[model samples]
Target chain A: MTDGILTPDQILSAAQDVLRRYGPAKATVVDVARALGVSHGSVYRHFPSKTALREAVTQRWLDQAHAELATVLASDAPAGVRLREWLGALFRSKRKRALDDPELFATYVSLVTESSQVVEGHVADLVGQIRQIVDAGLARGEFAAPDPAATARAVFDAAVRFHNPAHAAEWSRPGIEDDFTALCDLILLGLEVR
Target chain B: MTDGILTPDQILSAAQDVLRRYGPAKATVVDVARALGVSHGSVYRHFPSKTALREAVTQRWLDQAHAELATVLASDAPAGVRLREWLGALFRSKRKRALDDPELFATYVSLVTESSQVVEGHVADLVGQIRQIVDAGLARGEFAAPDPAATARAVFDAAVRFHNPAHAAEWSRPGIEDDFTALCDLILLGLEVR
Candidate 1:
């Protein structure tokens, strides 16, 4: 209802809705503005370009992921439980997003490979957070691994690799999650000293 | 060069060379014929269509992989060593194909997903071969796990996931093969009981 008082959050929420409906490739700024019931110029006022709008949408997703992880990390649950829950949530969320808006998911994955410094920074930050958890486990003698960072990287890569859209069709078969959990448990077992 | 008695192996060889040079998407029967210094009509004499030629090329690769696995399994080496070598060869060959001819690699990957029956047959055959090795190891107490079929599927899926061209840049990093070996070691460690 407010013309000039629309917040960035409002803009991003509207953009996400448009993304879900039309996908990232076809969701233009004008379409987003139309969905928001606002003038096309108002969308540009918040996001300078379509790429910026798409980036914001991706950043919002990442922010949500970080927020979820923070909640899990703050809980009284054991580190192993927290880590498993976090990964499960991550996988489910990615799968949902992929199914809801494949174009956006494809764009996000492409960004991971594209030589973009900003995307690399975001990825590195996420990796660093996972590494911290692994390091904490190793410090308490909970893990037997010599290289916590490497193990963390491997786990992160495995989770993402398993959830890839191309892999997901077959990977979504019966007992797939059970198999994934088994793999994760194996990693944890390997990290645990006898 | 012989017009009247071209073997299937020779046809496949010519196709592979053409694929390497022109990529899977651009490689046509005419191109394969030109590469072999034969008339297009002669090429058509052996293969009915471009799709048939592509299938022949893929089948050739599959045969090579099967032959290699057979040799590794029949070797007198220890199971663990055999597994490591087999996985190393698998990963290396996939990486080489992805880098050397990305279009063809993409086409092959697409083919697996394009038809469920085709992929199921391919997976079944591959799993059967790997299961034999795992079964032997289990009988000898070298492997502690019993579900060799499922484990074989996981290994094959992981290899496919890791060797994706999308991940090639990451895999090209120094000591990536070492990282993959570490991952394999983790899998092996998890397979062992105790």
Candidate 2:
């Protein structure tokens, strides 16, 4: 019950619950403290300000989004297949969050909009995963990219329609999966040629 | 001076002025008519309803956006050069709109959002142009796409952040042109491997 015993991780966990229940605009540090059965000061001790807490929550959500895809990225599969799977996993993770908990995902989207640093960090993380795949491809002689990082970014940009949150409204359209496959095939072919 | 004397093109030209001034939300059929110094009835005669008029205006904007690129599309240049020029033109057109008259570009973005049909038609036109170059590439054995239309859409989607209004906020970032070049090079490389 003491502030000394409470940890930042516990505060973050409770904050996520409060966020999901009330959404971003209505959720507050007090609300998160209430969810944790702790005093507001206790919560503030862990997070310097509400904005820092919100950014941390956004970073947490982003981390969760990439967690599954990280497995695919770390897998021993062929780099090309791993690249495709990584992208597919990324899209599925986001789509799942949107479909399974629309409110939470929407809240996360709003929070992300407010935290550009979190977004930049999240993007850097995802692109780094992509770079790993590109590096693997280069090692296997399957890709001829002169710069793996740049190639990873191009692949990311190419797949934005399928994975970018901005285009979420269009993802449910008919033939989207087919379009995703076709696009991946095209990009992979491009990578194969260097 | 009469309804019979005012052509639809004249009405649309005036409507664009109204839209640029008042934006999509406040712009009206009355405003368009006022801009042309004609009765609303004449405007209605050309466009059955306000929605129809809005759609037509959007189409007009899209047409103007593509006019120069259409020339590039119809050129006798190599398909690769045409494709690169076509994408470059499209990006330049959008960037020019965003830079020259951000208010108008923002208004057009909202108008396009409200009129999905107009957006779909515009995309189809752009993709169709892409398909033409893709088809030519296929014929010349510069591309190995089995379905030019699908590949065309892939290319269009790949370069979306540069052209799509949704990401207008990020377009102003420095090094955008370099990013565009890197992406185009990647996709072009992809398309080259039949």
Candidate 3:
């Protein structure tokens, strides 16, 4: 698209490319504008400030994964299967981002501290997905949870090593996958009807 | 304690004092000696190098906690109760160290990366303690674990947020204790023979 007709999507794509090149530190509204063949004002028009633009990039990256997870939830599989798949998908996606696109991955991770609301929303959304699966399990008499919300939170927190960015360094360890699987199995056990 | 004669414990105590005042980076044998009213050579006689001295200090800190945990394990309580108390102690000790002695905790955590063998041994030791509990539980037929070692690891990893230094910043968050107890309860459910 031409500079005059720059859409937010077009600008976001360009912003991603800029962030991928220079990371969040050196990359700025000016660079994003340069990448999109537009002035800084155009980028600012869509995102009021540099932090907003960076947050948008992070939000966009997270939304893609969210979309994929939404598909897993949309699947007609058993709640248990969906729950496992959902967590696996989250871990796999995060692992890939941390391993494959390290620059962009780091960009978003660094933003996580500054953009608390974004991070908070992302967590709440993911936990909500888990809650849905857990609530479904309880409703189907497939699981026994004294507190369904806490059950879901426990499951989410239980697998923290698999998804928490701080533990990303261990994600590549030889037995980390086995560790993830073991934790998942145990959580499933805890969630199943007792 | 004359200046000419000093025990390793005395040097270690002085080193701890020096570390508390100067942290690991600026702390040196000379500083430790000054604190102990002895020559730096006297300090070096007990510790060959700064790294060795720092490692010794960290080992001392961890050993004290290890001694406490050993007592918890020696208790005649049921394996389940022992397990709960054991994890609780680990969490509480780490939490207290991080909160009450921020400098020392930061020193240990920073040393963790460079001192992989130290960190690795610490983890192995802690995991072994958990494994002991799991083995006892299985021996009494009080817990159901297909793979006892993996069960112990899962339990440890499941509570990473409560104990991991990386999440130390969140240790002060309101309701974090409830979250810890909630996770422990879920894990206990997973462990008990069903």
Q: lDDT value for candidate 2?
A: 0.85
> Which of the CAPRI classes, incorrect, acceptable, medium or high, describes model 2?
medium
Clashing pairs in 3: none
lDDT of 1 by residue, A100-193 (tens): 7666667666544343665667767766766766766677666656566777766666565554455545454787776676556655555555
lDDT of 1 at B22: 70
Better of 2 and 3 by TM-score: 2
Candidate 1 C-alpha lDDT tens digits along B5-89: 7776788888887776676667788888887777888877878887777776776676664566677878877666777777776
What's model 2's lDDT at B168? Answer: 79
Which digits, one per residue and each the tens of the lDDT, describe model 3 over residues A5-72?
A: 88888888998888778877788889988887778988888899998887887888889866678888
What lDDT score is found at residue B146 in candidate 3? Answer: 94
Q: Individual DockQ of the candidates?
A: 0.34, 0.79, 0.79
- Candidate 1 overall Cα lDDT vs. reference? 0.67
Best by TM-score: 2
Across B36-144, the per-residue lDDT of candidate 2 in tens digits comes to 8788988898899999998888888888987899789889887888889999999988888888899888888888988778888888888888999999988988888
Evaluated with lDDT, which candidate comes out highest? 2
How much lDDT does each candidate structure score? Answer: 0.67, 0.85, 0.85
What is the DockQ score of candidate 1, to 2 decimals?
A: 0.34
Give residue A57's lDDT in candidate 3 (0 to 100). 77
The Cα error of candidate 3 at residue A74, in Å, is 2.0
What is the descending lDDT order?
2, 3, 1
